[model samples]
Target: MINAFGALRPDQPIHVFTKASRWLLDRTITVPVTIVEQAVDSGAIQRDSLQLDVPATLASAAQFEAGADEAAVALAREFRARHVQVAVCDAPPMPCTAAHLAGVPAVVLANFTWDWIFEDFIAEHPAFAELPARLGVRYARADAAWRLPMHGGFGTVRTVLDFPWIARRSRRGRAELRRLIGAGDARPLVLISFGGYGVANMALAHHAGAPYRLVLSGGAEHSPTDAPPDALHLDRERLDALGLRYEDLVAAVDVVASKPGYGIVSECVANGAALLYTDRGRFREYPVMVDEMPQVLPCRHIANASLASDRWDEEVAGLLAQPRPEIRPLVNGADVAAGMISAML
Candidate 1:
């Protein structure tokens, strides 16, 4: 969403609505944002109190639905007062319903919708059975939906438009960032990205003698107590101090070792970096990305067992050995989406 915001016309007015607890909002976004109280919180994978329990979230569905109802009323009131012409969101159900309630046209931007994701969990936990259909009904209210690359099926949306990758480009050069991280040596720099909700019990220390130098974000809970000399754990403060953003480090690296998520995949494609991915649980979006991402960039999958055991040398070599795609997909979906939104206005 930030990428699309940056791509919009300088004179265009925009407002962002997100959850209050979203960590990325603080780290990446600069625009004034409105916190939506009833917003569905992201699931965390760490072994901490903050970890999002799927069963718990499903059990509280009624509470979330009631919150969404209140949020829609408030948002609709605000939209009418402001005379807002169009509403844009990243596949949130409340925003779509709110826009509909305000009699405003809504444009949904996403690779996958919450409805599709929730359906995957219904078999394991029956509490999620109704969520998919309910969310789908709301999502279908959108004026249009922009489907990005490595996308999943959007069965509920009425009008779906395909778009290229929307990604953040690296402002700093590779050599400059490598120097900043003290990775001057010829060894490959592998960025371990598991998103803000980090993985627990990751054996990062076991890769001490690997051919690559590992770089982990400080936000990740997967860091071992006894880290190797080759590993570099950088927090947001360190990144800011070194005059770099997370995307800059991603662009600088030879390969990003991660579970296939939209953010990391798009960034890798935009910056011409290889991907060494692993399974990210039962989320339906994982298979879609793993299958489709390789056609755009060099991508190789490592098993979850291999990742946990730090047996990544083979996968890393395979990913590096693969040649990049000759005809790369355009990374200008943000610009294209901005134009589409402008046209609506």
Candidate 2:
């Protein structure tokens, strides 16, 4: 969403409201962001820990609901003080409700809503039965929604407008990124990314004799304690010193091996890199992304067991061998969304 925000009219004043997390603060977003501590938690599923912690998720939801009124009051105060005309959110229920409460026109940009996502968890914990409906009410308060592709059914939001993929493209060239990462053109470079919270017990030494060079970002926190010779762990500081962004590494890679998430999938598409994906548990968005990704780029699926056991060479080979799609989707959704937001202003 920050990438789309960057594309908005240069003269338009935009303020981003988000939780203060290392994952968000580390990125270079050219916009004024207002960090609202403890506004909400989406209870994101950890790829390494596939087991859904129903109790924890439910508790997080309750906490979010408990602070909604207070958060809304603060947001309303800010909106009035700034003379904000329109509020934009990447499909957060609280922001929509808060914007409505503040009497600010809210535009939601997302492929799926939390109401649709939480619906998948009701069977695991019956307490989650009411969450979907409750969140649906908040989502309906939004003035409009800009739905992206590869999305679930958003039954709550009243006014919906379909939009293209809003993905960040690489700013640097492939050769430059490879040189920065110390990866030569002789071997294939594969990026191992599992989002902000990386997988648990990831043994990078398992890829000791692998055919490709492995790269990991955000330091040794995610790297194997005994990493193999071929593995290159790029810390945040190293990346910053080299002037390379995450998207640049994605563009330089031959393939991305991980669970299929919207951010990674869109980046791979924009950079022309193949994807070797594994199952991301039972999240509703997983199936939709897995189904839709193959149409735009070369993609292959590997079981979680195969991924964990270091048996990913076959899938990686398949992904690399697969030809690129003759017709690719437009990678300029951020600009398109910016144009719409400009008109709205």
Candidate 3:
């Protein structure tokens, strides 16, 4: 979205506001601010820490909603102060509400929204029962919403082009990347990534019994200490220093093993790599992503419990045996979004 906007209007200012506060909700969300910080440091986008306000993790649903509402106020204050004309948001309704409060156009672009995610947990966690409705009210404030394929079915926004894939499209050939990563050519190298925060209770050593080389990205925080010595660990800092984004590594590898998040799934398919994914508990987007991604890529799923056991051996073998499917990349949604934002501007 940022790149597309820049392409359309190079002189326009683009500032990314990401939530930052200590939060213990999901380890998966724990490092989002850090990731954004890195992106800002990389000079990809300008950042204003003042607009980023979120509660600490472990806040109850009521507390979460209240915090988001409070954050919206701060976001509005920042927008007014900065004279922001349009708010292009990927997060929930907080940013959108801020845009509304500032009487500016709120353009939401994403595959999933917060209401759909909260819906799944509402039944079990009563604190979240009222959250869906609250989020719905705030989401309705967006002036425009541009959606992507295999979404959570929450937002009724017009479907835009396919979400842009940010990975480096061209990568070192398999043989070269394999040699650089110290993996033998006989076995395929699988890049394992579960976003920034690693999945809990997963043992990469389980794949040690398989014929492939397992490269775990950002897994040191959650991986068991007994993880296999042969398993490779690549933190984000090292990835940045090498001038390699995760998708570049993904493109070089034979298979990408990850959770069914939109960013990773879209990048894997766009890069023409096969997918070996697992569940992210009851995350609302997973079911849709799992159903849709297999249409374009050779996709296989492994059970959460089986992740710590030898069950991945058969699945990996089967995925490797399948022919690599041809990937026809879709038109990027960023351009469509940029066009829309341009009209509003």
Candidate 4:
């Protein structure tokens, strides 16, 4: 949403509705919603949190549904008060409900909607049987659903656009960031990131026996002795201090070790960084993203169990020995989506 709106013309005014979920904060490693709220508060964007209690986990569907309704009513009132005509969101159904209630056009921008994710659980747990249908009905109200690459295409919405990948461009040069991270010009830098929920045991990366510096994303607080003398934790604060964006770190690195997430995968592929990833348990997008590896860029699969063990050392060494090729996947997605939304106004 930040990137898209940044691409908008100067005349366009955009109001973003941010919300935080305590349920999500407890589960995620980074609590991204809080970061979004922080960004808004810091004047990075024109936005505010709805102050609603949104449930992030599927097990909390009952609470989520009730919360969504309350949030929808509050959000609709805000949209009307602001004279907003269009809305866009990635997951959860409340914003769609708000846009519909406020009689505004909504564009659902995501690799897969929440309903698509709920459908995967329905077969195993019957409690989610009605959820797919109910959520689908809410998402169907969108004017358009633009699906990003490496997505598990949605069954709920018929008009899904095969949207190009969206990634942040690198601001600082490679040498400068490497120097900031305290990595030597010769040694390779490997970044281990698993989104907001971090990997518990990264000490195993030390066993690779390669002369590489391992950088952990999200800053879980590590001792200098955690890995080798060279391993470091590159938290958001560290990146900010170096004037580097998250994507800048990803772009500057030799390899990115991450789970199969649309944002990370798309960024790695588009920016020409080697992707070494592991399975994300029960995530619907994992299968499609993993299957897309060989087709897009050089990638390797790291087992979940091996993440805590020293068994992945050989694979890590092999991946590090390979060359890094930059893959550019139409970086104009934000501009395109922004233009589409602008036309609606």
- The C-alpha RMSD of each candidate to the native structure, in angstroms, is 2.9, 2.3, 7.3, 6.9
Cα lDDT tens digits for candidate 4, 99-189: 8899998778877777776677677777657766877777877767887777764666657788777665666777777787777657677
The parts of candidate 4 lying over 4 Å away from their true place are 20-56, 200-205, 220-225, 311-313, 320-327
Cα lDDT of candidate 1 equals 0.76
- Pitting candidate 1 against candidate 2, the one with the higher TM-score is 2
Q: Report, for every candidate in turn, its global Cα lDDT versus the true structure.
A: 0.76, 0.76, 0.62, 0.65
TM-score, one value per model: 0.89, 0.91, 0.78, 0.82
Candidate 1 colliding pairs: none
Per-residue error at 263 for model 2, in Å?
0.8
Error of 2 at 297 (Å): 1.6
- Cα-lDDT of candidate 3: 0.62
The parts of candidate 2 lying over 4 Å away from their true place are 1-8, 32-38, 45-52
lDDT (tens digit, per residue) of candidate 3 on 102-205: 99988667777777766766666675567678877777878766767676644544333445433224355655655555565577777877654454454444
Global CA lDDT computed for model 2: 0.76
Candidate structures ordered by TM-score, highest first: 2, 1, 4, 3
